[model samples]
Target chain A: AQTVTQSQPEMSVQEAETVTLSCTYDTSESDYYLFWYKQPPSRQMILVIRQEAYKQQNATENRFSVNFQKAAKSFSLKISDSQLGDAAMYFCAYRSGSNYKLTFGKGTLLTVNP
Target chain B: GAGVSQSPSNKVTEKGKDVELRCDPISGHTALYWYRQSLGQGLEFLIYFQGNSAPDKSGLPSDRFSAERTGGSVSTLTIQRTQQEDSAVYLCASSLRPSGPTEAFFGQGTRLTVV
Candidate 1:
C-alpha cells in the first residue's frame, strides 16, 4: 500500500512571496506519478501540478512547481508569487502507473496574507 | 454537464437511515472515482471504476458502504444504516483515461451530515 504524508498542518505566506509545502511517500514501485491538488472553501479540488517519476526535470506550471526526489521518496510543492487565491488546503497525492487509484496526504492549509 | 456533477450538494440525514449520493462524470470519460473527506482530513479513496473492468472496492471502509456505476457513466454511493461517523464530504472525479499522464476533473462534492 502506498501512503502520502504532509508534515505541515498549516502554512502561511506573505503576498508575492514564495511557499513550499513538504510531502513524502512510501512506495516500492518505480513507475508512479505525483500530484498536488488544491481544495478551496468551495469544496472543489483542483489539480495544481503533476510529476512523473521517470522524469528527472521537475514539473512547473505557472507559479506552481514540484521538487520531486524519487530516491528520497519526497515530492514538495512550491508556489511562487503567492496570491490570495492560493489560500486553500493543499494535498499531495500518489498514483501507481499500473493503477488509477490515488492516495492523498492529510493536506496543509495555506494562508496567503496580504 | 461540462464537468463532473454530484447531486444534492448537501445531505443531512438521521443516524441509522439509508442515504444515496449520485455522481455524473464528464462525458466520454473512461474512469470515475469516489472519495470521502472528513473534516480536517485528506481525501480517502472509496471506490473506482474503469470502463468495463470490475470496480475496485478495496478502499471502502466497511461493508455498509457500497457503490455502483451504471453504463459506465453515472455512479451512486449508498450507505446503509448511516452512522454519525459517516458524515463527510463525498467527492467524485473523472479522467479521460485511467493511465499515463492524465488529469482528473473533480466535482464540488456533496457534504453529507448524519446526525
Candidate 2:
C-alpha cells in the first residue's frame, strides 16, 4: 500500500511571494507518479502539477514547481509569485505507474494574503 | 456533458436508510473512480472502474457499500443501512486512459448527510 502525507494542516502566503507545501510518501514500488491537486470552496478537485518518479528533473508549470527527492521519498510543491487564485486546499497524491488509483494526503489549506 | 457529472449535488438521508449516488464520466473516458472526503477523513479512495469492470474494489469500506458501472459510462454507488459515519462528500473522477500519466478530471461531488 502507498500512502501520502502532508504535515501542514494550513498555510498562508503573501501575494507575489513564494510558498512551499511539503509532502512525503511511503511505497515499496520503484515506479510511480506524484501529483498536486487543489480544491477550492466549490469542492472541485483540480490538478495542479504532476511528476514521474523516473524523472530526475522536477516538474514546473508556470509559477508552480516541485522539489522531488526520490531517495528521501519527498515531493514538495513550490508556488512562486503567488496569487489569490492559489488559495485552496492543496493535496499531495500518489499513484503507482502500474495502477490508476490515487492515494491522497490530508491536504493543507492555503490562504493568500493581500 | 463536458466534464464528469454527479447527480443530486446534495443528499440527506436518515440512518439505516439506503442511498444511491450516480456519476456520469466524461464522454470518452474509460477510467472512472469514486472517492470520499469528510472532516474526519480527508480523502479516501472508494473504487475504480476500467470501462464496465472494476479492477480494484479494495477501498470500499464495508460490504454494505457497493458500486457498479454500466455500459462503461454511468456508475452508481449504493450504501445500505448507512451509518452516521457515511456522511461525507462523494467525489467522482474520470481519466482518458488507464493508469500512467493522464490526470483525472473531477466532478462537483455529492455531499451526503446521514442523520
Candidate 3:
C-alpha cells in the first residue's frame, strides 16, 4: 500500500508572497503520479497540479508548481503570488500507474493573509 | 452532462436510517470512484469501479457500507443503519481510463448529516 504524508498541519503566507507545502510518499512502484488538490470551505475538491514520476521536469500551472523528487520520494507544492483564494485545505495524493485508487495525505490548511 | 454530477447536495437523516447517494459520471468515463471526507480529515477511498471489472470494495470501512455502479456510468453509495460517524461529505470522481496519465474529474459532493 502506498502512503502520502503531509507533515505540516497548517501553513500561512502573506499576500503576494510564496508558500510551499511539503509532501512525501512511500511507493515501491517506479511508475506513479502525484497530485495536489485544493478543497475550499465550500468542500469542492479541485486539482491544483499533477506530476508524473517518469517526468523529471516539475509540473507548473499558472501560480502553482510542484517540486517532484522521485529519487527522494518527495513531492511538494509551491504557490507563488499567493492570494486570498489560495486559502483552503491542500492535500497530497498518490496513484500508482497500475491502479486507479488514489491515496491521500492528512492535508495542510493554507492561509493566505492580506 | 458537462461534468460529474452528484444528487442531493445535502442530506440529513436520522441515525440508524438508510440513505442513498447518487453519482452521475461524465459521459464515456470508464472509471468511477467513491470517497469519504470526514471533518478535518483527508479523503478516504471507499470503492472503485473500472470498466466492466469487479468493483474494489477493500476501502469500505464496514459491512454497512456498499456501493454499486450501473451501466458503467452511474454509481450509488448506500449506507445501511447509518451512524453519526457516517456523517461526512461523500465525493465522486470519474476518469477516462482506469489508470495512467488520465486525470479524474470530481463532483461537488453530497454532504450527509446523520443526526
Candidate 4:
C-alpha cells in the first residue's frame, strides 16, 4: 500500500510571494506518478501539477511546479507569485504503476494573504 | 455536461435509512471514481470503474457501501442502513483513460448527512 504524507496542516503566504508545500510518500514500485490537487471552498477538486517518477526533470506549469526527488520519496509543490485565488486545501497524491487509484495526503490549507 | 456532474448536490437522511448518490461522468470518459471526504478522515478512495470492466471496490469501508456503473457512463453509490458515520461529502471524478498520470475532472460532490 502507498501512503502520502503532508506534514503541514496549514500554511500561509503573502501575495506576490512564493510558497512551498512538502509531501512525502512510501512506495516500493519503481514506476509511479505524483500529483498535487487543489480544492477550494466550492469543494471541487482540481489538478494542479503532476510529475512522473521516471522523469529526472521537475515538472513546471506556469506558477506551479514540483520538486520531485524519487530517491528520497519526496514530491513538493511550489507556487510562485502567489495570489488570493491560490488559497485552498492542497493535497499530495500518489498512484502506483499497476493501479489507477490515487492515495492522497491529509491536505494542507493554504491561506494567501493580501 | 462539460464536467462530471453529481445528482442531489445534498442529501439528508435518517439513520438506518437507505440512500443513493448518482454521478454522471463526462461523455466519452472511460474511467470513473468515487471518493468520500470527511472532516476527520480527509479524502478516502471508495471505488473505481474502468469502462465496462468489474469495478475495484477495495476501498469500500463496509459491506453496506456499494456502487455500480451502467453502460460505462452514469454511476450510483448506494448505502444501506446508513449510519451517522456515513455522513460525508461524496465526490466523483472522471478521466479519459485509466492509466496513471492522467488528469481527472471532479464533480462538486454530493454532501450526505445522516442524522
TM-score of the second chain for every model: 0.98, 0.95, 0.98, 0.97
Give the interface-residue alpha carbon RMSD of model 2.
1.0
As a TM-score, model 3 comes out at 0.97
Q: Work out the iRMS of candidate 3.
A: 1.0
Candidate 2 per-residue C-alpha lDDT over B1-115 given as tens digits, one digit per residue, 9 for 90 to 100: 8989998899999999999999999999999999999984568999999975645889999999999998899999999999999999999999999789789999999999999
lDDT against true structure, model 4? 0.94
List per-prediction Cα lDDT, in the order shown: 0.95, 0.94, 0.93, 0.94
Better of 1 and 4 by lDDT: 1
Name the regions of candidate 2 deviating beyond 4 angstroms.
Answer: none
The superposed Cα distance between candidate 1 and the true structure at residue A76, in angstroms, equals 0.8
**Residues B1-115 of candidate 3: C-alpha lDDT, one tens digit per residue:** 9999998899999999999999999999999999999987889999999999999999999999999998888999999999999999999999998888678889999999999
lDDT of 2 by residue, A8-55 (tens): 999999999999999999999999999999999899999999999999
lDDT of 3 at A83: 97
Q: lDDT tens digits, residues A1-114, model 1? A: 999999999999999999999999999999999999999999999999999999999999999999999899999999999999999999999999998988899999999999
lDDT of 1 by residue, B1-115 (tens): 8989999899999999999999999999999999999998899999999999999999899999999999999999999999999999999999999976698899999999999
> How high is the lDDT of residue B12 in model 4?
96
Instruction: Predict model 2's lDDT versus the native.
Output: 0.94
Find the 10 residues in a row with the least total lDDT in model 4 chain B. B35-44
Best of the candidates, lDDT: 1
Kindly list the per-residue Cα lDDT of model 4 for residues A1-114, writing each as its tens digit.
889999999999999999999999999999898989999999999999999899999999999999998889999999999999999999998988788998899999999999
Per-prediction fnat:
0.79, 0.77, 0.67, 0.77
